[model samples]
Target chain A: MLKEILYYTWGAVVSFVLAFSVGITYMGLNRKVTARVQNRIGPPWYQNFLDVIKLGSKKTAIHHGVMHHLGPAFLMVSSVMSLLIIPILNNGRFYPNLNFHGDLIFLLYIMTFGPLGMALGAGQTGNPNSAIGVTRGLAQMAGFEIPWVMALVALMIQYKTTSIVDLMNIQAETGRWLMFSSPFAFIAAIMAMFGMFRYSPFDIVGAPSELASGPMSENGGKYLFTMMSSGSVFAFAKLTLYTDLFLGGADNLLVLVLKTFVLYMIPVLYGVVNPRYRTEQAVRWFWGWPSFFGLLAILQASFF
Target chain B: MINDKESQKIVDIIQNFARKHSLWVLAYGTGCGAIEIPPTMTSRYDAERLGVRGAATPRQADVLLITGYLTTKTLKRVIRVYEQMQDPKYVIGFGSCTINGGMYFDSYNTIKALDRYLPVDVYINGCMPRPEAVLKGFAKLQELIQAGKADGSKKYKENLEWYRANQKEVIPVWRMPEFNW
Candidate 1:
């Protein structure tokens, strides 16, 4: 029993480390890609590592209250929790920590836990910008989550199961990725992803020009460092979740990285050329077409 | 076996190296010198290649870029912003206005010297420094950071009384929070 517990603990740590590094690298690559698109040579891919380290080494951090201190901690908790539950590889020796049946529904709820925790922290700061940003973030989350949940519900009804592992296993057995099998659900989820990633056209929550980075205006030093790492971890877990659900979960680490990177580019590339949307427009956007596709996915799942 | 002092030095080296590479400049567009920043940040002169990026707020910023001249009115806010910044912060006084008030030299309102009000690590000396000059100023700041010479925050803490005296002379009505570093 002790050895099993130790092994699970070790696996969780390794998975966290892997997810963080991959997520940070993807963010760095996003910067590089943005730079190249704009006819400029960007910073190196390892720039974020230097940034996180510098933030960690900073001498002072100010907090308004206990919630402010716990905001990033809350974000980290949600991120690690999601990483542990999301299976990293299909048949790997090291990954898929703490995953269980009916985890898909649990995953969806847990993913939003961090942001709400952060909102509580942001509210405690008494910064009006942080308040506005948190509202915008939550509103946008409400907007995107409809289609995102619809997509998941469609999959659940179609498969008659809530386990992500079961979904991957079904895909493996049929030798068909769900992206082709459930095209509307994929389309809806992809649209929702634009908001999920918080890119342009939906990036009002942290709109630097208008809101001074919105929810994160007061966070600095160690708080910012923790937030950054958690953001990366969360990003990786979300991407991995998408890959497992639609792209047929990876058989190995290299495949996992490749598939996740390809999945990651959808939002990053879309964010590059597009301009931002106001809060209402962003919320309305998700309600319009993505939600339409989501309905179609549900209809298709039930009848056909 | 390394001695404690040597081990400390090694850690400092690594810390300084990271600090030198990642500079999140607070976009405090104080004066006409702010015009030059857009060009410096955008495609023609991308500062990100040097790991210089704009930070949204003073709390998250490492470098405070004071663009253009400081009027007695704006100085209070500038001082507040500077204090809000965490430790190991830097100040880059941009343009000739920051150096000696430039065109505002004879103006009654503008402070002629920026150093009196705030500790400046680097000064880009031109009436309006071009993007090239701005990047050069950043490079110089990076060099200073690596050498452990850019200690403006330290200087501010050490001579808080004197700095407060200077700040009080211009502002007159000082109703600010007690700056506890």
Candidate 2:
């Protein structure tokens, strides 16, 4: 029992530290990405931190019920938990003993929990704008989920195990990276995940001009900071996952950083080129034909 | 009792999402006062430094910083933009057009009160308000941010009469647009 407790405790601690570091890096990188896209210079990495602190000192107001208040709290909880699950660095060497068996699938599902909680809380608060935003968000999730699941499942089949550690190990051995062997599989996966990350084109949820930050309309102070941090860390984890999975990680820290940054640019570039997807269009296209290919990849690996 | 680092980090994250990274400006630049938006945003006022930037589309922003005047014609677009904006959104009336109609009180071209069409969070005064007045409005918004005084979400839900007033015109239980739906 003590050993198990120590393992989980270590997991949480490691995740927190790693998430913090990568969060800073991505904050800087995203600024540059957005700045380039918007024809302006974005703020420094530490700028995000300063803004959060300033808002944390803002006035506090409670909405509808204790539930509305709890919304941000729950959102933060889910985001941190999701961050804790990604197999960053050599941490995957700990494998099934330390981590859950079906962690990849679990992590993906848990990832949605934070956003879902926020949406639900938005519903409870009863802001029609957010209500509309959350509705759109849920629809988009429904759209992209099939393609995402299909892409990951295809990869999972190739590794012949749902354990993320095993998948990483499989990649480590092949000398044949999945992205190189099956570039289509890789692109499809990234696109779906990228959409889920809610940058630019998929930014229908808190479209500030439209929904006034959507479900985030009511949050301020510490709660506001919490969401911002969650967003940054979540994006970091997402990019790291792509790097670790698709681009292949190196033993050297600099190599790993470089790979992550390149991978990060894919979505950022996509954002610059693409316009925000109307909620209905995002959903319709998400569940459309591209998802079919992802499903095909999975079936090919599983049966053929 | 709040020793949970996880929750604390989460709270910090939520706050940052609202304040720091993407301060979404509402799309509709209605009223002649809407002209001030350019200087305040692009260079002179530099709202960008405060993480305030205009979102070309409504679905991407959080703060709908309305500049002024709601002409009857523009009122349609203003309501449409308000509707276009996604959740967790905020509405600010930039000038006289926002509060009880700045100078268009007697003119049929302008809506008497901007709030009559949409919920207004902060109202900055002046015929064509200076950027300083706009800054004060932003500061007041910052206070709301500081105090965490966000009843906009809850109040909007429980009693939507205010938002309804913005979305539709009420004509004393008569002469209202009849929807066949």
Candidate 3:
């Protein structure tokens, strides 16, 4: 029992580190790519590392209450928990902390756990912008989760499994990636992903121009640092989850990075040229074509 | 073999280096100089390459860039914003107006100088400093940070009463929160 516990703990740590580093690097590359598109030389790839360090070192003054303190903590917990649950590699190769059957449903619920926790914290701050931002964030989550769930449910029905690992295994056995098999589900999920990533046209939650970063308007220094790191970790975990589900799980780290980076670019590049959408517009957008694709996926899964 | 003092110095150096590279500017654009900022941040100049980015709120900001003229009316808000910022913060007085009021020097509403009201670390002199000048100001501020010379926040803390007095003299209705620090 002791050995198993130690091994799990070690694996958890390794996965957390890997997720964090990859997430931060991806964010840096996102900035670089955005800059290149605009015909400008961007900051170094490690600019985020320096920013995080600087934020961590700075001191925070004035807290609204205990919830304000716990807000970032809650976000961190959600990110790390999701990271642990998601299989970093196929068949428990490097670190299989917790990849159990029916984990898909659990993963779905746990993913939004952080934002709800954040809303509570933002409420405690008494900042109107934070409240506005939190509402927008939750509303956007509601908008995206419809198609996201539909896509997942379609997969579950098609493969007759609710386990992400099992689905991945099925894909490997058949030598057919799920994207090609359930193209509509892939389309719906990718559309939901645009909102999930909170890139252009969907970034109203933290509209810095109008909302002062919305939910995080009051957060600074160490609080901001924790949020930033958690965001990076969460981004990596989400990318990895998508990779495992649709892209046939990678055998090694190199393949994993390549696949994840390609998936990440879909949203990052899309965000660069497009302008932002209002909250209602963004929500309506997901409910429109994405939801239609999701329904199609379900129909295809059920019959064919 | 490092003593406590030696180790402390090493930590300070690292902190300063990180802080220097990442300067989140709260551009308190109080004047025409604010126009130059967009160009500086955009494709042509790209201030971000130096790790200088615009921050939305005073809370997340490291440098308070006072772009252009500060009138008696705007000074109160500026002070409030400055106080709201978390420490180890720096202030950049942009344009000649911030330094000595420039064209607004003769105007009764405009404050002749900014340093009397707030600690100015680096002053960029121009009636309306261009994007290039703004980048130069940032580079100067970075250099000051590296040398451990930028201590505007410390100065504000140590001489709070003096700064408050100056602030009160300019504005008649002084109903601002007390600077606890």
Candidate 4:
């Protein structure tokens, strides 16, 4: 028992480190790509690393209360937990025993843990802008979750299994990735992923111009650092989950990285040139065609 | 194990390097000099290449860019913002207006010298410094950071009384909270 616990602990640590490094690097690439898109040379790829370190090194920190301090801790925990649950390599070669039998629903709930914790912390700050930002974020979450959950339900029903590992095995055996097999579900999930990525058109929560970063208006120094790091980890977790679900679970680290990076670019590239939507508009857009695609996906799953 | 002091020294060096590379500016454009910021940040000049990006709020910013002549009314808001910012923060007094109030030097409304109110780490000269000059000023600030000479926050803390007095004299009401270090 003790040996198993030690192995699990080691696995968790490795997963955390992997998620952080890969996620931060992806962010740096995103910035570089965005700069190139705008016809300007961007900062070095290590710019994000320097930013996080600089934020961590700030001379002062402010906390409204215990919850404010704990918010980032919760965000970190949720992302870390999600990373651990999502298998990174095929047949779970990387961390074999760590992938539990049934974590699909748990993964969905865990994904929201960061935002919910952040909302509570923002509430305690008593800043109206933070409150506004949190409201928009929660609303957007609700909007996206419908189509997202529908996509997941369609997959679960079609596969007749709750275990992600089982889902991967099914995909490998059938020799048809879910992306090709269930095109409607893929479209719906991809649409929801845009909001999950918090890119342009759907980025009402932390509208920098309108709300001064919204929920994070009061967070600075190490507080901001923690948020940024957790965000990267969460980004990796979400991307990995999508790759496992839609694309066949990657056979190697290189394939996994490429799949995840391509998946990440969908929302990011969309965000680069588009103007942002108001909170209501964002919610409406998610519910409109995306919801329709999700419904069609579910119907197709049930009928065929 | 390394001693605490040794660890702290190593940490300080790392922190300084990171801080120099990622300078998030709260460009609180209080005057016409605000117009120049777009040119500086856009594709033409690309301030972002130097890792100098605009921050939306004082909380997230490392450098406060006071872009031009500050009237008495605006000075109050500026002081409030400066206090809200977390430290080890730097202030850049941009444009000749910020140094000696430019054309507004004799005006009763505008405050002539910004450093009297806020500890400025760098000053860029010109009626309105072009994007090139603005970039040069940022380079100067980066040099100051590397040399360990830009300790404006520390200076502000040490001479809080004098700074506060100057602040209060200009604004008679003195309604702001004392931002204790």
Candidate 5:
């Protein structure tokens, strides 16, 4: 039992490290890419690393209350938990610990954990902007989750299994990834991901101009550092989950990185070129076409 | 076989390097000089190349750029912001107004010398420093930070009493919270 616990703890650590490094690196690249797109020189690839370290190395930190302190911790837990549950490689031998059957439903619940924790923390700060940002974030989350859940339902129904490992196995056996098989679900989920990534058009929650970074307005020093790192880890978890669910599960680390990076670019590129929508407009956008595509995916799964 | 002093020095060097590279400026536009910030941030100057980005709040920001002349009213808010920021923070007295109130030097309500109330790490002496001069000021701050010369936060902590007296004198209706470093 002790051995099993130790192994599980070790596995969790490895997964956390992997998600954090990849996610932060992608964020740095996103900045560089955005800068280049605007015809300007950008910070180096290690810029995010420096920012994280500097924030962490701050000599002082402030908290509104216990919840404020617990907020980032909760966010960290959710991301780490999600990362642990998601399978990175198709081969079972290397990462066999957490890829259990009947985990799709659990994954869905855990995915919402970070935002809720963040909301609680933001609420504790007594900042009106943070409150407004939280409300918008939760609303946007509700908007996107409908289509996202529908897509997940369609996938589970089509595959006749809730285990991510089984879904990945089915792809390997049929030699056709779900992205091609259920193109409608892929489209729906990808659209939902635009909001999930919190880029342009859907970044109303943290509208830096209007909301002053929303939920994180009061967080500074080590608190902000924790939020930043947790955000990166959560980003990786979501990307890996999508890569596993829609794209075929990767067989090797390099393939996984490439697939995740390509998937990561979709929302980022869209964000760069678009203007933000108001809260209601974003909700309307998500519920409109994305929901329709999700329904179509469900229909496709049910029929021929 | 490194001694304790040597290891501490190495860590300090690393921290300084990281701090120098990443300077998150709080987006608090106090005066007309705020106009120059957009050009500095956007493609024309591209402050991101120097690892300088605009932070939305005092807590997350490392540098407080007092853009121009500070009215007595605005000085209260600026002091509040400077206090809320975490340790190792720096303030740049941007534009002539921030240095000596520039065009507003004789204005009764405006504070003439920013350094009297808060520690000024770098002073850019233009009526309104252009984006180029602003970037140069940032570069200077970064150099000060890397060389372990930027101790503005420390100075503020040490002279909190005197600074508060100055602040209280300016804003007689002083309702600002007691700064605890």
Candidate 6:
């Protein structure tokens, strides 16, 4: 009984450390890359850590009763738990790694929980501001996700397996990244995915200027810290997942960093060019034609 | 004496330490003013040099800068978030919206002045201010931080009676879900 407790405790500690470090580091780099693209000297690489520390220690003011408090927690818990199922690699290489399939589709869907819970939590506060933020969030989720998910389906069709291991092996044998093998589907999914990341123009929901941090307005102290840390970790996790999926060719950490940063930059650049989408206009843009485009990409992958 | 208020003081001190250095904006894309926040803080304008950033959650924000007009529909959410923020929190009214309602000042649906409901410190003027102007606001905030002000906590400690009554009388946005005035 003691042994079992020790084992579980040890696993929890290590998982937290790994996820926390990797998550913070990647977001630091993301800040830097985003900084370069936007033409400014962004915060120190350790800024996310500093930010979380501040949040964790602050005075927690709970707003709108219970839902606001619960929402940030719900959003955070689901994201941190996802680490358990993910295969943490010792290095970026596919062969010598502790990789697991991590129920990839589950990871994607559950990740949505953090944002959705946040949206609902904000809504329940009876914050009309958050209600509007929720409306915009729902629309953006619809627009980009259709293409992103459809592309994932296309990739699944090609691989014949959903397992991460199988994905890597298939790539190694074929010597092709999905980006190279099926550029359109890959690009569509990535474009949509990055758009969903809310790096820039896609930041239609949670308009800080408008909604006052949207749903998170009422959350303070450790509750707020958890949300912030989870988000930072989530950002890094996203880059890691995308790196493994597309840029696995580089042999070393430095090379991997270069490729990953390049990929990370694509969306940050989008921040420079576009402005926030009006909620109605954003929904309309996705409704009729873009969904059709995603369908086309899936078809092209299958036929061509 | 770890009374609820005293324990809160220690926590408040640490939170302020964290708050002064790194500020983040929430994921909310509520108003057009959000568009300008990113570039000022990202690589393009790099708001980081001044230690200003757009965070994804309120837990991370020190200054809840309200940039645009708040409608009856949105004010409740804003007040709730303002409540969620840790004490010693600083609020910046970024444009006309939070001050006198800006363009929406006379609108039947919008709140007249944010201060009618919540407390505020700094104000950045513009419909949608330029990145430079936004950063200037950041710089002003930083200067206050350097002076050890870090946005006061008085509003939180002020006798509750005034605000409770004011919330009811002035900012009816506090009453229920949405009451079109």
Q: Write the per-residue lDDT of candidate 1 for residues A33-146, one digit (tens) a residue.
A: 999999999999999999998999999999999999999999999999999999988855454388899999999999999999999999999999999999999999999999
Encode model 1's per-residue lDDT on B1-181: one tens digit a residue. 5668989899889899999999999967889889999889999999999999999999999999999988899999999999999989999999999998899999999999999989999999998899999999999999999999999999999999999999999998999999965
Q: Which of the numbered candidates is closest to the native, going by highest lDDT?
A: 1
Instruction: Return the TM-score for each candidate structure.
Output: 0.98, 0.68, 0.98, 0.97, 0.97, 0.67
User: What TM-scores does chain A show, candidate by candidate in order?
Assistant: 0.99, 0.89, 0.99, 0.98, 0.97, 0.83
Which regions of candidate 1 fall more than 4 Å away from where they truly are? B1-3
* Tens digits of lDDT, candidate 3, A43-111: 999999989889999965666899998999999999999998888788888876787889999999999
lDDT per residue for candidate 6 within A1-304, as digits (tens), equals 9987776566656755655776676667667766665566666777777767766655545556677767878776776656554434423332233335646677678767878888778777786766777777877887777777776677677666666556656676777787787666666666675556676666777677666656555555676677767776566556656666655444554665566567766777766577777776766665546566568767876777
How far does residue A287 in candidate 2 sit from its true spot (Å)?
2.6
Clashing pairs in 3: A201-A277
TM-score, candidate 5, chain B alone? 0.96
**Top DockQ prediction, candidate number:** 1
Q: Interface RMSD of every candidate? A: 0.7, 8.4, 1.1, 0.8, 0.9, 5.2
Query: Model 6, stretches more than 4 Å misplaced?
Result: A1-18, A21-41, A90-102, A249-256, A284-293, B1-17, B23-48, B52-85, B90-181
Against the true structure, candidate 2 reaches a TM-score of: 0.68
Tell me the tens digit of each residue's lDDT in model 3 across B1-181: 5668889799889889999999999999888988999999999999999999999898899999999998899999999999999988999999999888899889999998999999999999997888888899999999999999999889988888899889899999998888753
Candidate achieving higher DockQ, 1 or 6: 1
Better of 4 and 6 by lDDT: 4
The weakest ten consecutive residues by lDDT in model 6 chain A span A90-99
* DockQ for all models: 0.88, 0.08, 0.79, 0.86, 0.86, 0.32
A16: Cα error in model 6, Å: 4.1
- Model 1 residue A92 CA deviation in Å: 4.3
Q: What's the residue-level lDDT of A55 in candidate 2?
A: 47
Q: What lDDT is reached at residue A291 by model 4?
A: 95
